[model samples]
Target: MISSEDHARLSQAIREAEDLTTGEIVVVVSEQASSYRSFPVLWALLAALVVPWPLIAITTLGPARIFLIQLLVALFLSIFLSFPSRRHALVPRFIKRARARETARREFLGRGLTRTRERTGVLIYVALAEHHAEIMADTGIADRVGPEVWRGIVDELTDRIREGRLTDGLVAAVRRTGAILAEHAPPRFDDVDELPNKVFVL
Candidate 1:
């Protein structure tokens, strides 16, 4: 969902953020955690299955007409669900959040954020389809920064995203997190660039 210009700016922000701290920060964006791909077909089938019942109970429609009506209902609903926006809306809120968090955690591990020398890697993750964001922190940093601190950053970033300021929100979150890391884990003489600074997109 990010544009080319935004990607460059976000990468630059990451570069700057890592300059003053040994802690590693990674950002990842995903179109969606899971497709929930079968939902549309299920909805269409359900629409077809349910139509016959109402037709049989409430109306004196003949079998042929009822079947035709059921077929039409199924076709219409299937076509409606073919739209990505409509299909996404059918996914439950809890499922969306859970999937986003799961995906973020997977990325944290997949990108080697958990293997940093000081256990100080943090991930700023966004799932655009669900409009959800998560901040995943490793033990070294979370031990110093309370849960409330991380919550505040997630909340603020979510608000900015809702306002359509994703790039700005990410940069601000990176800077804010960088300041906190600099305070708790300032660069050492032997500090290494343990991870890349690019914005990971999936």
Candidate 2:
């Protein structure tokens, strides 16, 4: 978690270096944790559905026939059970509509902020936490600038928050960064102007 003193100092640096009035700075306090969870029960259930394949084979004409039947059964079962399991198991409890309303009230009272989900290719998230907040961008940024620069950018943003002028600091950082990028990056043209006499009669 970033101390208020640090936030103020960073904010001041950004304000002095860049000319900004309104924006936000994101400070990641720790490494991002993996979001995937292992569901033993779900895996076991799926395995159980395949266990009868041998019995089907011995009672049938050939292995291929038995395998095809088992495949169909598995597909059917997967489709049938996936939806309810997702609603009950996959989604976070606090994210359900009714629960979200209650959670939002508590969050507003405590932090004066709310959570929001952003979609870019896949769903990314931006949420206020106990001591800090997160800013999520698409994976493409890493591809474009590489991880080191990307991390540096995030760190710079976090540093700017220390100045006690988050809004102005961020705005200036964004504008100046954009200018630097524009200067160093290659030019892009949408359409070329055609010469009037260059048309050919075919």
Candidate 3:
């Protein structure tokens, strides 16, 4: 969902940030982590089950009529929400964030962020649909930086995302993260760049 220019901004942020630290920083943006294809169907079924109750209590409808109405409503809702455009709303926020976290974890490993010689790799992962972000520091960095620090960065980035300025948010967070790394994981003279700076669209 990010433009090339925006992506470049993130890459630049990474490069600038990493220049002062041995830590490797990677940024990843994803529309969402999981398909959640079953949510629409489940919600439709739950809604249908609820529909018959109101009808039975308020409409004086016969059992057969209620059943028919319930079935039709369920079918219509399921069909309508099955479209990708509308499906995401059916999934809950907590589930989306959880999946995004899981996705980020996988990406951290997949991108070799966890493989940094000093274990100072840091991953910045964003899920557009979930409006969620995570900052994962590898062992060496995590041992130095507390979870509260990363939580603050994630919170700030999420606020920017809600305001539709994801680029700005990322840049700010990247700089902040870079500063943190510069303090705790300052670059070694012999350090070699181990990761790409460009943001990967997942």
Candidate 4:
């Protein structure tokens, strides 16, 4: 969902952020956390099932005709609800947040954020489809920082995403995270780049 220009800018932001702290910051932006294909199917099925009941109650149509109408309703709904916005609407907010969090956690581990020296790695993850953002801090930083700090960053990032300022939001989040890390885990003399300072767009 990010352009090449935005990618370059995000990478630059990461590099600058890493300059002041030993902490490894990785940013991941994903189009979505989950496909949620089942949502369209579930909605289509429910609408079809309900449609047949009303027809059965009010119409003198034969059972076969009623069944055919139900099938057609299901087909139409499946096509209409297959749209991304429609499908997303069918999913509960809690489910979207949970999936986004899970995706963030997976990215944090899969990207080796936990394997950094001194365990001072932080992951800034954004899921565009779910309109969610999260910051994951390893023990080295988390022990020194409170959850409220991360929450505040997430809130700002989410606002930016909602305003269609994703790149701007990410850049700000990276800077803020770097400042926090610099305070808690300033660069070491032997500090080396332990992770790729680039935005992973999934």
Total backbone collisions for each predicted model: 0, 18, 0, 0
Please write out the lDDT profile of model 4 over residues 30-113, one tens digit for every residue: 999999998898889998888867777888899899889889989999889999988899999999999999999999999999
Q: Tell me the lDDT of model 3 at 124.
A: 92
- 92-136: candidate 1 lDDT, tens digit per residue: 899889989889989989999989999999999999998888898
| 76-100: candidate 2 lDDT, tens digit per residue | 5555545543424543444443343
Q: What lDDT does the true structure give each of the candidates?
A: 0.90, 0.35, 0.91, 0.92
- Scanning candidate 4 in windows of ten residues, the lowest lDDT window is 50-59
Best by lDDT: 4
Write candidate 3's Cα lDDT for 10-125 as tens digits: 88889999999999999898987888889889989999989987787788889999999999999999999998768988787788878998999999999998889999999999
Q: Candidate 1: global Cα-lDDT?
A: 0.90
Whole-structure CA lDDT of model 4 = 0.92
- Report the lDDT of model 4 for residue 122: 97
Give Cα distance to truth, residue 112, candidate 3, Å. 1.0
For candidate 1, list the clashing residue pairs, or say none: none
Please state the error at residue 105 of candidate 3 in Å: 1.2
Candidate 3: stretches off by over 4 Å = 48-71, 84-86
Look at candidate 3 and tell me the lDDT of residue 193. 89
Report the number of the highest-TM-score candidate: 4
TM-scores, one per candidate: 0.89, 0.27, 0.86, 0.94
Q: Could you tell me which 10 consecutive residues in candidate 3 have the lowest summed lDDT?
A: 52-61
Rank the candidate models, highest lDDT first: 4, 3, 1, 2
